[model samples]
Target: MTNKKMRVVTCPLTPNQLHDAQLDLPKNAKAQAKLLAYFETTEEDFVPLKQLREELGVSGQAIQKLVDNGMLQFAEKKVNRDPYAGREFERTEPLALSKEQQAANDEILLAAKEGRPETFLLHGVTGSGKTEIYLQSIAEVLQKGKEAIVLVPEISLTPQMVERFKSRFGDAVAVLHSALSHGEKYDEWRKIERKEAQVVVGARSAIFAPFENLGLIIIDEEHEATYKQEDNPRYHARDVAIWRAKRHHCPVVLGSATPSLESYARATKNVYKLLELKARINQQEMPEVHIIDMREELRSENRTEFSRTLLEKIKERLERNEQTVLLLNKRGYASFVMCRDCGYVVECPNCDISLTYHQATRKMKCHYCGHEERVPEKCPSCESEHIRYFGTGTQKVEESLAKLIPEARVIRMDVDTTRQKGAHEKLLTRFQNGEADILLGTQMIAKGLDFPNITLVGVLNADTMLFLPDFRSAERTFQLLTQVSGRAGRHVLPGEVVVQSYSPEHYSIEYAKMHDYHGFYKHEMLMRHKGAYPPFYFLTLINVSHEEERKVIQTIQDMASFLRTKLGPDSIILGPVPSTISRIKNKYRYQCMIKYKKEPTLKNELKSLLEHYQKEQAKGLTISIDVEPYVLM
Candidate 1:
């Protein structure tokens, strides 16, 4: 207080500026100058309490209190600006709906207002404008100042769905999918949390979007197996949507042409309200389907995967200047290689499954663990030179189509071809633009695609997934066949599907051919009841894996013992058994399956069992819990 004169201080340097300034000075000079500057900035006689606080890195609150006590005058409060503050988002007006769509909207709105969850089968065949109903419901939610979330199975389908949402909802819609950059995802999540977005559309993960007031949740293609997450949390997006709806005291709309057996069961039991949209918007009829028995082809050794009927249909479509789609559920060039004389099959070293021959790479690869090897010229067993590619795949089908119809431009869309960024859209666009006269691919081409010119669809092998070990195989096969068939006949002109299968009379294939969903459901339900599969009982799978086979088996055995002790003798324990593919990625796997009635404490018991296993496991043992796993393998 000797001379309390106000001292004038120059603008304080930022940390970066100070660092740059220190680089230009000699070592000693830099140290001395920094010390002098520090003292000069902190000296009581030269600086006020507020300025001293600023120099010493004190917060605004500390300086404010000092000022309130007459110990400081003023302080500078630093404010950081958000980087994404001025970023623009696309916005568009909602589309006008037709009378049918309006009626659907009113029905959904009525249910939503009553706090009731409605399950709409949307039995409308493909191209029925079911997506429009979803949009209408979203619009109503937005109007009520609440948020909406739309869930799709695959992110590959997100781009199209996002565009549709953006076209209707504009900037109010935000998309959250794995494809988004981390920063983009964070920004989108933040936007939703801030209540800036009224609609969130994405793949499975979008179900968790932190919307302030969720009014409705839509599960598109609700029957698709991709809705189930295979990893930790093991949550089904459809199930999560229902849970979230209850949490928010709102309604959830599950829109799917092929509803899952679980949802169908719930609807039939009066647990869920069932709404059906049985007609197409444009009044276009479902495609006619024909099954070509493969037994005749095998007897004749036709060698071609495509049947004669399918070939003739493709030729007709080509002649009419219409497009075609050829589906082979298998993706490699050949499903497996075998020795004719030794009865030896080429198998994967890392997995118990056989390797498929990939023609493009000339390599045999295990689809389960991605193990690969050069395609052998001779059989390892018996030294036989009779190794041959046995079964056909998508690539082989594409090659066959090219050889048969050279004039038609053919495009193959499968995991191998569409692995790169933007490739899926590129291939689809080419097909849509008529650059590709025939599109050939695996299961991907079967879902949610609308092409007007595709008058003919061919299933190279409809029986591939029909006889899988899982009980849901028939249901899945039916859904795939029905969906692939729906891709045709979307436009004004009639369309046709040719199915090539060994089991031509199988109920799944027959029902799909007739486009009879109820008939298929009834037959499949009989099988499910006979097998004691879902809707009748709950099943949980615990998979134990390790580099050592003995360790995995032992761990699973111990787990089964513990589960039996805790869950009592009433619970069924299937195995300490090797998985279908016993080894994957060099890890030996064993599984323990638990099936029980859907009791009130079933989930809790499962959770506790998993936790107990996690704590009891020794080194080198890992366990995964899958509640209602889609595939046992």
Candidate 2:
């Protein structure tokens, strides 16, 4: 008390005067002030500098400068806290790498040591030691007393990837993803913020992990659209990673066999350094792609769900004791049940789309909305018994395969089958153990699986996404085809891909068959330039949903009008019309799209509109704002 009184009298203002000033403040403000004053006098019970900085919204440099100027002092000896406090991560030994991996590692280390933030696009083909390169880069950063953040797409939530990281980095690694519980995520976040974890790994959100001394950022599957969150703060993990790396003066590595057009453009323009790993780690050759024209099948009346060529290939793989993967983008038993006599399709009452037939449930269900109805005995339109299922889905494909192979075991992996946790891994494990001869699934089976025995890959309906309305549809189709094709032929045996498409000559399909990214990009970029799509112009999609269709449309129209009035002539607004599907999950949907040319403040303006709309819109209606939405549908 004597020392406190002496110090108070020597200050510019007396303790009594400060107390008087605090007395008239709000309760929370007064409490905060009192806590600060107590900490100054009671050094034995003071908070850490890091905690103080966080609480006061101050920067580390600012706090250090304050201490250097004699305005602040440490209350106790600094103690290191646990970075991975209250988090669980699997621990394992480092993976043994081949010569190719070693070379890649050395190159990355040399780039980092030179203090030049290298933007290396590690175009390592699948099974070409890309993960090893990632580990090597992380090790280099760790040795330099810095941190690394690895961003993987959501589909890579497999135990294999998790185990690999845990074994290599042990306690220094912290994972951040939507899969973690809220408390666990908070603890892991704190660990990273406190500098207890040197390496951070997770899906898209891991890009925001607060690593104090971030030195390296690794973006695996950089071409994945999932990296770009469709909702608010619609940030792309790859883009954000590059931005953060620049901020920290660190190196960024984007690894992918099929890199995004934007990334490819940057690398081509010399904004990013391109590092190509053309061959597989063991020099495995790329899969031989065969185009099975469905047009020919339809003409020959050989379209019994499975094309003859595809069936023959599957049988050959089965006889050879090799595994087979069949990809069908659709998920239900049939796309729709229609009345041939009346020309009526079984449609969802709530949405402007047909209901898909689910054989397991014997019900017609809406893929967009959860609307369901029992399969009708007769046509609901004309009461005629002429209803027939049209189009094929994964369920129909699975059914056909079971009947065709008979002796071979088949497992279907899709949203309907793997809705439960651990089901995805269970299916993959079964297939890997040879318990299933044929693994039929949607896009999930197309990624991150390194099965050497999978000598045959079948893409049913390869043109499904080619005719999509989005400008990036071609790019997406090429990426999916290439990625899925890369999953095969990782071992000694050559692999083959059979693509069944009506439009075999389509640029996307043709480029995919050739595994030609440059060709695809050049062709797609031309279309984008004509249409004024992304990487050329920024886009913001405003979605308004409500139970009442008219109200939703009116609100969106009002928003579009407001934006038009506020924005300059350089900005263009479109929509205030029904969405592609019109309705989803019982809510009528309307959308407004805004396109800006070099407008950095576009996002801010959109955010402000969202905030204002949240307050002005009726209570029953809901509004969702998506910046740079991937799909219009």
Best by TM-score: 1
**Tens digit of per-residue lDDT, candidate 1, span 1-633:** 121234332324454554554465466453334433554344333344445546666555643543454433443332212222354436655557666667777878887777666555444566778888888787877788888899878765776677678777777878887766566677787777777788988888989898768888888888998888888778888878888888887888777778989888888886777777777767788888999998998788886777788888888888898999888887888889999998899998877889999988899998887888997888897988998998888888778777987887899988899777557767887888889789998888888888789888888888889887788888889999998998897878898999999999999999999988899889888888887778887898989888987777777887788667767545678987888878888888889888888445766866776677665465656788888898798
TM-score of 2: 0.79
Give residue 543's lDDT in candidate 2 (0 to 100).
85
Would you estimate the TM-scores of all the predictions?
Answer: 0.82, 0.79
Candidate 1 clashes: the total is 2
**Residue 434 displacement in candidate 1 (angstroms):** 1.6
Worst lDDT 10-window in candidate 2: 1-10
Note the Cα lDDT for every prediction shown.
0.78, 0.78
